[model samples]
Target: MRIILALLSGTLFGAGLVISGMADPGRVRAFLDLFGRWDPTLAFVMGGAIVPMAIAWTVQRRLESPLGDKAFSLPETRGIDTRLAVGAILFGIGWGLGGLCPGPAIASLSLSPVAVAPFVLAMFAGMGLHRLFTR
Candidate 1:
């Protein structure tokens, strides 16, 4: 049941990415290109995403447990640290360079493997390195 819910959620998220044009590297890169051909479409997408997320947070505050989980396992972190800063910087660099963040990158894999493979590989490598060092 939980696995089914997880799969459904992921599928919905991937659909949203594709429908919102987020799965296109050129669209994402244009959004990041502030001083260049700045595209504000992704900003609208972000704003649209935030609406439902905000409502979810409100609902979460009223619920003891999620529908598919025994309890909410939310992030407990509430501080700005070196690791956080470095990770953010690294993420920004990767996004700017490859124009693909995790969600969009993963969603794009089926559409454009030749372009998405390296970014996905590097993303996994970065995740593995972070776990290795942080642990």
Candidate 2:
């Protein structure tokens, strides 16, 4: 049941990305181009996401446990440390250069497998390296 729910959720998210043009690297790059021809579409998309998430957070606080889960498993860390800052900076750099963050990159894989494969592979490699070095 949990696995089915997860799959459904992921499919819905990927559909949203594709429908919103987020799966397009050019669109994402345009959104990031501040001083250039800036596209405000993604800002609106993000704003749309934030409102629902804010509501979800509020609702989560009122619940003892999420559906089909023992407890809500959220990040325990709540500080801006060196590792956090460095990770954010690296993520920004990668997003700016590749024009596809993890969610959008994965969503786009089926659309352009040849082009998106490298980014996805590199993303996995980076994750592996992070785990290897951190441990």
Candidate 3:
């Protein structure tokens, strides 16, 4: 049941990314381009996502457990630190240069395999290296 819900959620998220033109690297890059030809479509999609997320957080606070889980395993981290700041900066740099973050990059794999496959491969490699160093 939990796996099914997780799969459904992922499918919906991927669909949203595709439908909103988020899976397009050019669209994402245009959104991030402040001084260039800026596109505000992604901002609207993000705003739409935030509404449901905020509601979910509120409901999560009142719930002891989720429908498919024994307990909510929310992150316990608080406050800014060097790790957080460095990670955010690195992520921003990557997004700026690559023009696609993980979600959109992954979603785009099928759409543009020749271009996106390398990004996805590099992403997984980075994740593996992070796990190795963190552990």
Lowest summed lDDT window (length 10), candidate 3: 103-112
**The CA-based lDDT of model 1 is what?**
0.92
Instruction: Kindly list the per-residue Cα lDDT of model 2 for residues 21-48, writing each as its tens digit.
Output: 9999999899999999999999999999
Per-candidate local distance difference test: 0.92, 0.95, 0.91
Error of 2 at 119 (Å): 0.4
TM-score of 1: 0.95
Give model 3 RMSD, 1 decimal.
Answer: 1.2
**Deviation of model 3 at 70, angstroms:** 0.5
RMSD values, in order shown: 1.1, 1.1, 1.2
Measured with C-alpha atoms, the lDDT of residue 100 in candidate 2 is 92
Cα lDDT over the full model 3? 0.91
Per-residue alpha-carbon lDDT of candidate 1 for residues 1-135, written as tens digits (9 for 90 to 100): 899999999999999999999999899899988999999999999899898999999999999899998999988978999978988998899888888899999999988989899999989998898899887
Clashing pairs in 3: none
The TM-scores, one per candidate, come to 0.95, 0.95, 0.93
Model 2 stretches astray by more than 4 angstroms: none
Off by over 4 Å in 1: none
